[model samples]
Every structure is written in C-alpha cells, then in structure tokens.
Target chain A: MAAPPGPESIALLERFVAALKAQGVVTEEEIAEQIARTDRASPEIGARMVARAWTDPAYRELLLRDGSAAAEQMGVSMAGAPPLGVLEDTDTLHHLVVCTLCSCYPRMVLGYPPHWYKSAAYRARAVRDPRGVLAEWGTVLPDGMELRVVDSTADYRWMVLPQRPAGTEGWDETRLASLVTRDALVGVTLPMVAERAAA
Target chain B: MQDDAPPPATHDLGGAPRFRCTPVEPDDAAPPDAFGKRVDALRQLLARKGLMSVDELRRGVEAIPEAEYHALGYYERWLRSISGIMVEKGVVPAEALKP
Candidate 1:
C-alpha cells in the first residue's frame, strides 16, 4: 500500500485551497460540481456506444468516422474534452492503448482510468511488449496475429471498439452492452460471452 | 536520416528495456478514493478558471525529478503538478504552498 499523505503535505494543500478561495479563483461549489460530473462518467456509457455499433452498421460507420459526434448523438456532452478515437479490433489485428508519458484516457466515455492503467509498469510494458502485457491480463492473441499499440497522447484519447463476440447474434443493444466490460473497451481483454453465464 | 535525437525524458518510457521485467498488477476497478477525487476536483477547477491547461499539467508532471517522479503515487503526482503550475503561473504564490 502507498503511504498516506503526511500532515505537512495536507497542510500545504489546505493552504493552497485557502489561497485560491481568497483570490476568488475557484469556489467550493465549482469543485463539488466537477467531482459530481466526473463521477457520472462510467464504462456503461462506452458500452452503450459499442453495443449500438455492433448492431447498427450506420452507427458503426459514424463511430469510426467521428467519435465525438457519435457520442453526442447518444446524449453525451463532449464540450470541453479532447477528440475521441475509436480503434476497431479485427480478426487478424488487435490494438492496445497506452500513454507512456502520462495517463491520457478517454474519460468522457469510460470514466476514470483504472489503477493499473496509470502504473509505470503498464505504461512502459504496454508499448514494448503489448502481446506479453495482454497475456498477463489473460488475453493471449493467436499466433500470426498482429498487435498494434497506439499511444493515447495529450491531443487525442483512444478506446477500443472490440469486435462483437460470437454467440451474441440477434442480441439487443442492451443485452450486448452487458458483455462489454471496461477492460474490453481498453483492449486489455476481449469481451467474453462466458461472462454472461458467470454473471 | 538524422541520428542526433535527444534522450527521452525519464517519464518517456514507451519502450525502455528496463521495465520489461516489471510485473503489472491486475486491474482494480474501484473509483478514485476520496483524496484522489479531491485532487482531481482541484485540477478541474483550475482548468475551468483558465489558470491551467492539461498540457501544462502534463509538463509539470514530466518535470518532476526522476526519483521523486517514481516515488509518488498517481494522484500525488497530479496534485504536485497542479500545485507547481499554480505557483509557476502566478495563480498561487510560492509562499502559499509552504507548509
């Protein structure tokens, strides 16, 4: 476990907040609102998009061509966030995303990044040995398949549009969305039909 | 082809060989704890005030000393970067950050 912030560090942060408030630079209400807004985001939003894409070819095209607009079409507000890019996983190729410099996630759709995504171990290994990293996550790709690692830099954030799993044909968007986990959207693992039985 | 590229910063670990052997922990999907949410809220508030941008925040994080950079946790680094940028941008005086 990481060490708790020392009392001195807490004091420093308290002082800084007090200073900002004195200057009218920020308000407590604004900070509370921001936290509430961030809390509203979750993987379920992304799953809704993925399930729609899987069932509707036209929506899938729109998602690939313009991610932000597609997200807006689903009533998600992308007013201040960076452009969202969707990486389509295919039969012969898979894509994994990492930000080697820092964690630049698609927070508007997928909520806050998972703890492991921000770790130095993940940031370094995801780019160098994506296949190995995926394997450690129990996501071994078939031999001869190509693995592409995309860097989610400061300008653009990325999420994977994992291919629709088999045995899910004719499933409605809601049911299909149930299978798309947060890990699948990040490309760390594929959406599995087996989860339905387990759940 | 030019071969004189400068060495990557300590934070730039895209394919550095040293991390190849490090083990990655399993995913923990829990939301950010209370302290982390507070730090994140602070950052969002700063950005809304136009006092800082995400790029500036990233720069501040990347500028941390290598040893300290590795030692700090995720949101700790974020809080450090946010405070540093606030001082650097004159949004907060350096003395205000002195504990």
Candidate 2:
C-alpha cells in the first residue's frame, strides 16, 4: 500500500482547495459531483458492452465501428472524453493497449487505469515485447497468432473486445459479463467459462 | 540522422529499450485512495470549468524531472500537474498553494 500523504502535503492541498473556493473558482458541490461521476465508472461498464457485443451482432458492429456511440447506447456517458476505439480480438490475432506517452485510458468505460498500466516497465515493454509482457500475466498466445500492440493516445482511447470463451453459447448477458474481467478488456487476459457441475 | 533525433521525454516510454529488464508488478485492482480521489476530483472540476485541459495536464506531468516523476505516486503527480497548470493559467495564484 502506498503511504498516506504527509501532513505538510495535506495542509497544502487543503489550503489550495480553500483558496479556489474563496476565489469562486470551484465549488464543493461541483467537486463532489465529479467524484460521484468518476465513482460510477468501473470495469463493469466495459464488461456490459463486451457482453452485449457478443450477443447482439448489430450492437457488436456499432461497437466496432463507433465505440463512443456503442458506449452511450449502453447508458454510459462519454460526453467530454476522447473518442473510444474498440479493438476486436480474434483467434488469429490479439490486441494489446498501452499509453506509451502517459496513461491515456478509456476512463468513461473502464474507470481509472490500473496501477501497473501507469508503470514505466509496462509502458516500455508493452510495445517492445508484448508477448513477453503478456507471458508475465500468464497470457501466452499461440506462436502463429499475431500480437498487435496499440498505443492509446491523448486523442483516442482504446479497449479490447476479447473473443467470447467457448461453452457459453446459451449463457445470458449477465452471466457472460461476469466472465469479462478488466484484464480481458485491456487485452492482458482472456475471459474463461466457469466449469459446470455434473447433473 | 538517428543521432540527430531528440531524446524522448522521460514520460514517453513507449518501446524504450532501457526498461526491458524491469519486472512488472502483479495486478492490483484497488480503486484510488481517498487522497487520490480528491486530487482527481480537483482535476475533473478544473477541466469542467475550462480552467485546464487534459492535454495541458499531460504536458505538466511530462515536464516533471525524471527522478521525481518516478518517485511520485500516480495521483501525486496529478496533483502536481493540476496545481502547476492552475498557477500557469493564473486561475489560482502560487501563494494560495503554500500552506
């Protein structure tokens, strides 16, 4: 766990906020609203979209063609965020996302970026040795499969539409979404079907 | 010609060879702590008010010295960037930041 901010740091932040309020630069309600909006965003939003895409062909097409529209279709607000691009992963090809410059994530869909995503090691190796980096996460792709590394930039954010796991043909959207982890959306891992019990 | 190209900024780490040997930590899905959330809220508020843009914040983050960039936490870097931009834009005077 990271250490809490030092007293001096906390004091400075408090003073800064107070000064901003005094100058009518920002109000407490506005700050609280922003926090609430941010808190509402999570990996589940992306997972729901992925699940819908898997079940609805038209929605899938929309998601592939216009990610921002697809996200809004699912009740996610993408008002001020940069355009979102969904990378479709297939059996023959896989996509991995990295913000090589900084952590430019699809926050409106996937919430804030994972801590490791912001690390220098991840930012550096993700583009150079993607397979090796994925290997560290135990996501080993087949030798014949092509691994595509995409850099999510300031102007555009990217998310992965991971291939649906097999043995889930009859699964409902909720059940399918349960299998879609944030790692899968980021293309670091694949969603797997849970084993069933014998009848 | 390759030698004439400017060195990449410290924040520009895409495909950099120096970090090849660095080991990535395991995934931790924990949300930002309270302090981080507050810092993020401040940034969002600033952006909403047209006081700053995401690109300006990124530029401020990129401008940090290499060592300090590595040492600071994620939201701490954001706080620095947001605060710097506020001062740069004359939205909040530098004196207000000092406790």
**Which number leads on DockQ?**
2
Could you tell me which residue pairs clash in candidate 2?
none
Report interface Cα RMSD per prediction. 1.8, 1.8
Report clashes for each candidate as comma-separated counts: 0, 0
Which residue segments of model 2 deviate by more than 4 Å?
A1-8, A194-199
Per-residue alpha-carbon lDDT of candidate 2 for residues A55-153, written as tens digits (9 for 90 to 100):
999999999999999999989878888999999999899999999998889999999788888888999999989988998888889779999999999
The digit string of per-residue lDDT tens for model 1 on B34-75 reads: 677878899887887788899989888888899988877777
Model 2, residue A92: distance off in Å is: 0.6
First chain TM-score, candidate 1: 0.96
User: What would the per-residue lDDT of candidate 2 be over residues B1-99, giving only the tens digit for each residue?
Assistant: 298999988998988889999977746664788888888899888887888898899989888999988888878888888888888878888888975
Tell me the lDDT of candidate 2. Answer: 0.87
Which run of 10 residues does model 1 chain A get worst, by summed lDDT?
Answer: A1-10
lDDT of each: 0.87, 0.87
lDDT of 1 by residue, A25-130 (tens): 8888988888999999999999999999999999999999999999999889998899999999999988888888888999999999888888788899998788
